[model samples]
Target: MIPPKGKPLSDFPSLPPGFRFGTSTAAYQIEGAATEDGRGPSIWDEFCARPGTIADGSSGAVAADHYHRYAEDVALLKGLGAHGYRLSVAWPRVQPAGEGTPNPKGLDFYDRLLDALVEAGIEPMVTLYHWDLPQALEERGGWLDRATAERFAEYAGHVAARLGDRVAHWVPVNEPNVTALLGYALTAMAPARGLSFDALPAVHHQLLGHGLTVQSLRASGAASIGTATNHTPVWPASDDPADHEAAAFYDLLWNRLVADPILLGAYPDGFAELMPGPVADDLKIIASPLDFYGANYYNPTAIQAPGKPSAPATATAAGHVEVPSDLPFQFAPMTGHPRTDFGWPVVPEGLYELIMQLRERYPSMPPLYITEQGCAYNTPPDADGVVDDSARVAYYDAHLREVARAIADGADVRAYYAWSLLDNFEWAEGLTQRFGLVWTDYETLRRTPKRSYHWFAELIAAQRA
Candidate 1:
């Protein structure tokens, strides 16, 4: 049974000894200063410029200003008692055009951030790419072109060589499935292409790039390497056979399409034939062994066969990507559960189910890391400046308990990183979705730690004790 909401942290099961806890943030989401210090424009920069793309019509130009305020952010992490901090290196910032000479300023910025993290006794996990492709590469066909994968490998090598020694863990890519599905197929994210099923090449190219990146980081003597893939449990809307088939297909596309290549070294049936380039040879590179696997879990999805006349309109109204009428499946709402501000269901047990399913599917899978898991709640400070975000605190409480339950059942879970440390630019949705433990005033640039932050700090202290 799922644990009751808002249970005291002390009531939750103890996490395994040596388990690590941290917070996560992507570069473009937090490190504003889009044009500062030789940082080249990323596809997101162009995507946001287009009218009607972002809900709030805002860009990450000055997003939390982490580029100029790394010291302060580090202190926030330190105060939160985070054992690790997962951050992404902006590719455009490192190699402005996604190729050619490295940017010293970009490397130096991470250099200083790492120094601060090291001084604060926080291990750093650096993700090489988080969907911020340099506009130059997007103009060259981006992930759809195999050449872009080659460019990604080169860029990975440069960043790994520069900061690999300082980073405790390296994640080559963040949510490739989302990158391919939303950005290319659905046109819901940056570099929105709306290519539909033709976007399969982007998926193959991303996996190939991930494989090459693992090789690059290893060559640079990186310590630990993994990936952050968003995973969800696919539930059929009903017991109908058609619904089951549609859910299975959605699962293959959203979960196994990404996992099978990395964990098993072979695409699921029907996928290899659709991919670009030499498939058999590429599988070998795509299946490189990893030190761990990062699972970014939020909520499970309910799917049904297409042709529900109201499905498309209902999903679009709820801020979901519109299900193309031609697609085999459509998303059905998972009713009877609490939802976050972003409209994601609060199903803590889904995390446990996902881990067990993965374990059963891949016997040789690597250790697991709960890489990115948090909710979005608009909890601004009150008159006294206290941010009472009890819902977020309850979200974390329930989710962490689920992780413990998974661990008890012999899942090799290692670490857990909250989705974000500070509220910053949420891509596509813009600044509207706040998923941070600390609230950020976009106008004043001031941060006020919410109630969840204090609760998390206490939970960490209890775990250590």
Candidate 2:
């Protein structure tokens, strides 16, 4: 690797062949214009309105304005040499009230998007939902109600009937586990704003919705379908029995909770024993035949075994994993190392180990995709209207090398899509957090790719060469 003028470029390694490279953006994150073109209010729209919901006090009400500037974004995708583009279709935008006849306006937006991908020689990998549940659905109990799952299937069908003609790659639901846990179980950063609820219903219903949607898409002649799940490595704090047991519990909740049921046709041993009620029947639907499995991995959690000389742990500011005081395993916060703007620990090695575990655990699982892996950094602007964003550049450099290392060790990895194409309205944190290659002036929504974008393009050129 060539070192730059004054500083050394990251010493991270390069990628392997047949490993795809792409960029990802969600519907709610980018495609703003909340109430435009007859689009209805998403749960995010309502969430952003609630006091203290978003950090920057801004809503996707008029985000990157991708709805208006998507042409430029697609052109940006082509310029970046993206092999594929992973984007989500807004549930609210497409189905308006989340029921009945589809909204022609919402479908039209995707119609142009898919067309743009085809024209640009980029594969359009679509995510059906990325946490932007229509407010209309929430008004009817959202995922908590089994009817929401049926509605998802119906909505999926409407989408497939239109875009399915050209778009082959499909991810039924992006991080349903997170959608349930964050939206329902933990806190309301999303739809059905609530905390610590009977989320099992939402969980099962979401998975069932995936199965039903996959079936619908499959029937529509769509060739590819999968789901993106977020996983974290749980490390035991010590050898003490308390620590080991606590680590196991955390593992059941964070890592295995979703994959075990879908890939193994059952939850982890202790997990099923802990579930709320008789929802075993839903597993049948959740365990649909997926074409691939996309996992969104960031950092691993250290278990910090109890009753031993406890090692220092890093606390996630996002409060991603909830550890109770009485619980044996407390989140050992990772610190010291340079962190992203979001304060997530910057550890690439965790990603390497994560892939190995997936290989060991679910050998029968489908081909894996690094669904979402990118960091938010303090994206500062330069004099020439550009953001140097070197922190983000390093994050991707290290992570990509880990990705390459995993592929060398025999993981059926197909692709890597950066977390975003452009920074838009970050939920909860709102516009304060920037997790994108392209920087957008919130007011003007002018897209400007940071240094990372150039670095990625150079890497792609080198990868191809």
Candidate 3:
């Protein structure tokens, strides 16, 4: 059963003055019209076309119809009293072939969206790449090749030159670790390459792309620049030395590999030596200063050395995918904790621990932002026509409390953007997962606010007050 909403603003944790509260959406996840406005096909488009790729046998071809109803979505944001709106400018939308000419029609759509956001008093934060690599670039070696990094810089420059004036916050890339590890190394995500540990080059190239694009965004006179990295705490399954060592290695691979280069201008110990190309030279580019650091936290993961404790992972309300046991470290399920619809344990303290770790690990860590944090739950409308997602409200409240605790402990977190504004097309899981605060009737494409939406709106109003 879903938990009930807690209390009013006075009873909840207080955030600092001018701290941003917003919602996020990715291009391939929310923006439909995949083939319209001369938009070139993306890797996601290709992946979805293949049978058995998306669980629901559905694609983002129509999505929530946000491409045609962005105004309505903007209105939703304004009504929620959002201080910011984090969105991605589809690379293929701007440069259909990933290089060469810019698509005027594609740029026009974002121009209108930005103008509307500004009119609604919402700060627009633009993310350059969000897992939707144009198929043209993928065909030519994708992130594995150095040329893709150069082409990415060119593409960033194109969008920044046009929208840089209005958009203050610029994210060059989002969750490169997820893209390289899942999409390239593992078979879970798009462009399902499944190269396993051999996909190290993709990681380096993505970071290189980020660094190059940071320079491009700067040249375009963008004010605030950052990249969203997916982060989570790694816990050992037991006190055994092998378990601890395996957990440490997994941490180095999952967290430190990409983060160290960006925040500290170096990779985790020997990992850098393994990355392809002139890594020493690339580190200088990868370590470019960021105005802020964006972290997307889900939950902490427990690990054990391979071939130890083969307990079956209990499926949650929505089930979960099993981790490959052949890896150096095996994932052990968190035994006792509330879970979301995605079978992820609801460990809000992990967010606090992650922020504190960043503070302690990197002395030069930029101001932090909870760029993406939210859960997926099947809390559709009830018989009274109300989507009373008290579970989501509790989830937000608990996480915000943790954020407030971190702030009190002197962590410089400045923003929190929920993972999504509306429930549209969830990648891989397809329509099975609903992470939005607003419910969408996919058939009629009608938008309906859930109970969590109102709860969040009230909190935003109280913050301003």
Question: TM-score winner among the candidates?
Answer: 1
Please give, for residues 266-309, the per-residue lDDT of candidate 3 as tens digits.
88877877888899999999998999999998888888888877
For candidate 1, what is the total of clashing residue pairs?
0
Give the higher-TM-score candidate: 1 or 2: 1
Model 1 weakest 10-residue run by lDDT: 309-318
Better of 2 and 3 by TM-score: 3
Best lDDT goes to which candidate?
1
lDDT agreement of model 2 with the native: 0.78
How should the candidates be ordered by lDDT, best one leading? 1, 3, 2
Once superposed on the true structure, which residue ranges of model 3 sit more than 4 Å away at CA?
1-3, 310-322
Descending-TM-score candidate ranking: 1, 3, 2
- Backbone clashes in model 1, listed as residue pairs: none
Which segments of model 2 are wrong by more than 4 Å?
1-16, 192-197, 238-240, 270-280, 304-329
Off by over 4 Å in 1: 1-5, 309-319
lDDT string, candidate 2, 1-465, tens digits: 212211333443556677788988888878878888888888888877888766768888778888888889999999999999999999888888999998898899999999988999999898998888888889998888888888999999999989987785899888877777667865646764454536766776777788789888888888888878888877775566776788887787667878888898898775565454455876776787888888987777767554444434343323234433443556655555566667677788888898889999999989999988888876678888889887777778777778878888888888898988898677777788888888888867777888988888878877777
User: What TM-score, computed on C-alpha atoms, does each candidate reach?
Assistant: 0.97, 0.91, 0.97
In the range 276-393, model 1's lDDT, one tens digit per residue, is 9999999999999999999999888899998753344332211357767888999886788888888878889999999999889988999999899998999788999999998998
Model 3 residue 399 lDDT score: 88
